[model samples]
Target: MADTTQDYTPGSHPDLPPPSSEVGVIGWLRHNLFATPLDWALTILAVYLIYVLVVPALDWMLFSADWAGETRDDCSREGACWVFARVWSKVFIYGRYPVEELWRVNLTFIIQFVGLAALMIPGVPYKKWTGIFLLIPYPIIAFFLLYGGAFGLEPVETSLWGGLMVTLVIAEVGIVASLPIGIVLALGRRSKMPIIRAICVAFIELWRGVPLITVLFMASVMFPLFMPEGVNFDKLLRALIGVAMFSAAYMAEVVRGGLQAIPKGQYEAAQALGLSYPKVMTFIVLPQALKLVIPGIVNTFIGLFKDTTLVLIIGLFDLLGVVQLAATNPDWLGFAVEGYVVAAVGFWIFCFAMSRYSMYMERKLETGHKR
Candidate 1:
């Protein structure tokens, strides 16, 4: 044993730092951006493109942009006239909702903000109750607050509801209303009953086949012709219904895809345990299916949010629509670009938030199942 036998053991030696060219920012750049000739070329090309396009855009948007001003006359034509956005900010948010009763709108926004914060933020207690409050009573409260014919409040017409307020209302209603409808459709599509399946398939296809704009148009126009003579639907109501139905069709397909991904063994196992169809679906299948389809569901929601802008065609001004309308004002003329930029930024923020939330949910769910 004492003979010249050298000890050789992995990890016995003190760990030395990795090479400078293989571990830090330079290493990352080398591995990811310059790993090969093609990567190097692409990295250089991307940088050049960004410099050519984004740098000047940033300069125009930030450094050169006019921020402090009261009117279009105060703006210099060399850069963006953000004063247009500033002057019309209230109009962009509250639209034609009377200035004297703006408190109701402000209150509704406050309540919603609190409710959403409770629901989304971690460690909030009694979340189920909070969710129920948001899902059921909050909508009624919001409607009354915004519409305000009840509770001795002044009545604001649906026509007065435009801008970000209307946009959010339509989007929230569509999102909340569509999910359950979509789930039912998806289940019906997969049902063993031929009649149910046929009806679901027909409904989904009918909505999905047509463009959303056409659906909105029909809801605003042709839909009322079939109704009773004295009964008239609010244009915003029609648009909301149309948007919900249209989104539900797409949502049904997404949910159905998730349903199909579940292994047959799981269903058989649930049945073996003496679970009924509804029980199995509620307790096991739907939970898994919905989790699997979070990305698709959120994608649908983002699209639906953006599609609220299309309601402008039906004469319901959403956020973008309001901005466009404000831009046309005689005093604010020639600032259409600034208004559009504001709307674009607003949309991007919402869409990006949704996307990030989707990613967070995915990571939280730890959906590691193999497809």
Candidate 2:
């Protein structure tokens, strides 16, 4: 007897045509840019805007640009004067950080890169513990490296630290220090105890309600009054405290949102399993909550990074501060556009890369919630 069952092939569909050549670039454009009248209109508008902005930029940055030679005087062209940039590149990157001690900053960058790379790798066992260790000791190591008061190295004051180096230090320290403090605040805000919740709420609200500049001012000027008569805090330390406190307030709100998003079922289930509140939070709820809000956390970090530039307002030299300083230099005068453009590009690249990484992490950690 012959079998009458229909046959199934694992491969291609016989009824469908082979993939079309137009389905790549042309198809993508058609679908995304010309799918409907509205899309087409938007695409045209975007193209026009791009042309309006980019054409002139290209002309200034490349076509009529002066890339070679020394001094602004050499470039008599109508394009961007990058000669000024070339002359003051070190000042923009390192500020007044001594030329001889530049190696220390470079070494700090190397260590930070290595540590971050290690933390990012998923295959590393005990990753959480490793991250904790990196987080805890990094400030101390970075401080010693940058300040250089120990190990027979000459003492470098915070006032001398400027440029991107200061920006990175402030941002990194703020984010790291704020995280745990934020976590505690978030927990307190949701705590059963009225006093704890009230205190947390007040702290978060007070900090968030005020502008960061005012906080920085307080840190720089008012903090000295609060200190003991003979002792004085470093300007950088004061700025760090201001940034950390401001960041913690915002971070607390972000973490609280994460906590609210977590299902009550998870909390009850953890309790049902005879686990303590801390254990439940650490082992079950917080992991899920944090994963859910990773993007928000990264956004906060990006904001903090950008805000670190504001230290210039309180007389602390950061990346933007250094750029402003270079722009006003008598030797390289009348090059504000070049200096600002460089700083803006640097900031854009850093923030853009961080935003992209956050998106990647979100996708990498996404798990289907289908029941």
Candidate 3:
């Protein structure tokens, strides 16, 4: 060392430090969950709560469950009687939809799915018109399939329709039908003509002010009074009308927000370019407005989907109604939990996927605007 070797000094090297025992998983747990007495207590309580919930669920649903059987009687254990679900699944999904005509529903589903997928694809030519066609013809084809008197197919009354299938059909139709109606109402509300604005405001406020159940009641009972005699509509159609009208009012407000969000300069610029009002709106304004309100539109749709459950209250056998029916069956008694779980899972999956897609579209359209 005296000859030229440098003396080693602690903390002299910037990169060197004492080894830390407080930087790994143990350290993280200690800092986050056990750093203080209160933190440790809360963490233990949360763990116990989770265990209480999760363990029982796992035991009933998996460990002690009976899944394969022809009847609820086959399930002899003190656990989830999933055999009820297994036996009655078809009825739950299709209601009394005639085993032979099940394929029609499947076909409609395929067509709708393909159409929606096409609509979602980027850079597709004539996408707007394609979407419009998809939205318009869906109800017609679905109607024919579900309520078949055409092409020699037996007419299946809407009263017999139920399960997830009906829920989807109602939700889709409500969303599709409401969009144009809502857009028009929104535009009318913002129109320069005082009469048009007043009319639009009156319609929107009248609808938005009332509960959906009351509107549904009016549709079921009062709507026929308004219509000429011998021009009867199906109960399902009446429900659809109620849902669409109610949704349109809310959607109009949403679209109005989007319209207001667009800069006034855009309108002036479109006018300066000699674009007529309709062209300015269709090409320049509505697209931007709709893009801004995609989330709201999706939310409206989710609400409509959930509201379809209300059809049960009106004696329509939709998904919830069918589940309730199944629950009340003497053969499948005490399976309310299972039936509701199935319905809830189905609704959750649909609403969750739609909400996620709306968020994605918001980001995507934002990118388009930036470009």
Per-prediction CA RMSD (Å):
4.4, 6.0, 3.1
The candidates, ranked best first by lDDT, are 1, 2, 3
Error of 2 at 80 (Å): 1.1
Query: Which whole-number lDDT from 0 to 100 does residue 70 have in model 1?
Result: 90
Give candidate 1 regions above 4 Å deviation: 1-43, 367-371
Off by over 4 Å in 2: 1-45, 124-130
Checking candidate 2 for backbone clashes, the offending pairs are none
Candidate 3, 11-72: lDDT as tens digits: 68456553464777877888888999999899999999989998898888788888878876
The CA lDDT of each predicted structure is 0.92, 0.88, 0.88
Model 2 over residues 1-371: C-alpha lDDT tens digits? 78866566776435766366448887788777899899989999999998999999988887887888887778866998898888878877788999999998888888888778777876767768767767777667777888899987778888888888888889988998899999999999999999989999999999999999999999999999999998899899999999999999999999999999998999999999999999998999889988988999999999999999889999988888988998898887777888889999999998998999999898888897624
- The sequence of per-residue lDDT tens digits that candidate 1 reaches over residues 1-52 is 6687657698786677999999989999999999999998999999999999
TM-score of each: 0.91, 0.88, 0.91
Q: In candidate 3, what residue range of length 10 has the lowest lDDT sum?
A: 13-22
Candidate 1 vs candidate 3, lDDT winner: 1
Report the C-alpha displacement of residue 196, candidate 2, in angstroms: 0.8
